[model samples]
Target: MTRLLGFPIADHRRVFIIALPMIISNIAAPLLGLVDTAIIGHLPDAIYLSAVAVGATVIGFIYFLAVFMRMSMTALVAQNFGADDMAAQRHNSINGLFLAALLGVLLILLTPAVLELSWWLMVPAPALQNLASDYISIRLWGAPAALMNLVILGVLLGRQQSRQAMWLVIATNAVNVIVDVWLIVILDWRVQGAAVASAAAEWSSCLLGLFWLRKSLALGWHHLRLNLKQLLVLLRLNGDIFVRSLTLQLCMASMTAYATRYGAIYVAVNAVLMQFLLLISLGLDGIAYAVEALVGQAKGQGRSDRVRHWCRLTLLWSCLFAVAYSLIFIAFGEHIIRLLTDIDSVIDTAGHYLPWLMVLPLIGHWSYYFDGVFIGLAQSRGMRNTMLFAALLGFLPLWWWGQRFENHGLWLALTGFLMMRGVAQAIWLKRHPQTLL
Candidate 1:
């Protein structure tokens, strides 16, 4: 018991077993963006890169709004697993996939309207509107496959099948990169090619994921049938997470919208910088995924003590990793920027704001870790509330005030928002420990 409390070697092993594969997978996932950006960024014109950035942001906004499916699936499946309820786990996965399919179809249907509305909101320059529109038009074709992949991934993580989950992500991105190079570089299909590659990869991976889970699919179909009661429960959980994810994506989209006001150059620069930030968030998320699985399992077993232990050790390691990210960025961030784009102006502008990038990991790491903790505890409402407070109260006001500083102001507001979320959630968890049990 003493050894367990003192960061036992066994605990570290458990954490890494789950975290390492996730970390590798998460890292690979964002490289999709990096690869796209790098390929497009090298174009003779920066407009293509900016258009992809804006288009991707719009697609991400829609996709993330639907990502509540992923989050809820992970938590509930993890809890069910911990309680040794395999039937419930299978049921959840089946329900989640059905919902993912419906939602994806809805997104495809709404793409035209969404694209028009997005342009109105973003108000990009005339030249950019058509290019971005073309990119988005092609990308939405894969909406069904993309959302389905999210469910498969969430279920995989919930089942603690990290290695399998890693492969799914790797395969998806690998196909994306190969297609990206083939069409964009070899055939000069440009931004449209990037979109096609992404869409194709999604379809390919969805088929692969279904094939991989054929055995589970067979068992799940036999053991249970879907029903309204179970789905309602999932929907209620997904509802809160939906709002939370939507708000989060909106806040992120605002950064891109704001950048558009400054011109395609600024948009291009922000895209590159945002990619760096994405890498950091996803990398740290590897640790948070472990927290979600372990803490959630502990909660299912009614073992609050185990919940506390996993949270503590995971938090320690996540923060350490966050600090390491900051240091690496400090040392070599400019070089990374150079690798992403040959545009001299983009590189210089990105370097100016590089300090903000260095500090963001430290400020944002807590929120990422706490999100996992709350999700594991099935405290969806708390997650929603904290994010609202952070975005509405902390981020917007700081952003408003920081406008005096231009792009630096945008970074400042985002930093405050992240800090507010972490602090608020931490206090809540401290005050209401019952949630964990």
Candidate 2:
């Protein structure tokens, strides 16, 4: 019954227990990109870094469009965990894996067309296009593993098995970094080396995740039988989240596409700046993930009070973390950019836009926190609606009007998009107070 920071020690302990490992894990996720960028950035031409950036953006566009698998699994499995329904948890995992596999195969099949369309739209320099295509061609092979890994991660986090999830992600990215150094740095494989390293890591992590979850995965044959009702529930939730995720990725990819119009310098600069944004968003997502599990559990137990309590705590922790990120970026943004690249033009161009990155955490944390809350409650409709509103009404207009400013305009659009999501989510929560139940 002891208290700390206006909450019981037990409450605080539970939050940190679920959050710390995730914070570490999610932070490492973006750090992997930073490692990739740093490795590629040191090459003789800025073109290599630009190629990797374009390649990554295109692949991410495809993969993240399907991240609904991970989001839905976490919400569903967490609720099952709260209800102490072990069998249902296993069932959800199995169905999610099946869905993930199917989607992965579809992505692979569409790769040739996607690559052609992506480059056609972006239309970068001829050399950049070829190098990026080289990276994409190899990277797509890991789609199945990467998608499968997302389900594995969702199940682990939903079960509150944060330590296992953390290890899986860390080990995966560690392999990636090591391979990047060997293939890209030592062998000088250029952009293709980075692609192989990432693809290898994805497949390795998929195997490792299965190993870690072997016990939970081992179920009676009956549990493998798909229940149409439960599967429908999963599909419905994932469908909403899919729309939300796709919209979000389109906004992100649009920024990259717009940046290309300004030349390779802008594209390279945006790529470097984006890493800072990713570091902040993914790091803050740790707190959001905790909120998701806890809130979902509380909802399963029919404890509306606990739901509200966790939501409030999510806001508080997210704010503190956002402030910390803003301060760090403001103080050391240039220093960080310098470490990522030796190219003087990239360094200077990225510095010009670091201010946008510095303030993004403050503008964006609310939507992230609210996203966790809604996902926990299995109310992805709200998330989908808010994201659409932000992208359409806020981001597009801002970008159109600000186009004369070039790269700065793109950043401005992104800022508007993120801020709109947070504001809209806040308003939605206020209006639908009953969602806590």
lDDT string, candidate 1, 95-193, tens digits: 888888888888789888988899888799988999999999999999989998988888777778889889999999889989999999999999999
Clashes by residue pair, model 2: none
lDDT of 1 at 365: 95
Off by over 4 Å in 2: 30-54, 123-135, 177-197, 260-269, 341-355, 404-408
lDDT computed for candidate 2 = 0.86
What total of clashing residue pairs does each candidate reach?
0, 0
Model 2 quality (TM-score): 0.87
Model 2, residue 117: C-alpha shift (Å) = 2.1
Among residues 3 or more apart in sequence or in different chains, the pairs in candidate 1 whose N, CA or C atoms overlap within 3 Å are: none
Worst 10 residues of 2 by lDDT: 216-225
lDDT of 2 by residue, 121-170 (tens): 87898898899988898998898889999899889888888888899989
* lDDT of residue 160 for candidate 1: 81
Question: How far off is residue 256 in model 1, in Å?
Answer: 3.6
TM-score of each: 0.87, 0.87
**Looking at model 1, which ten-residue stretch has the lowest summed lDDT?**
216-225
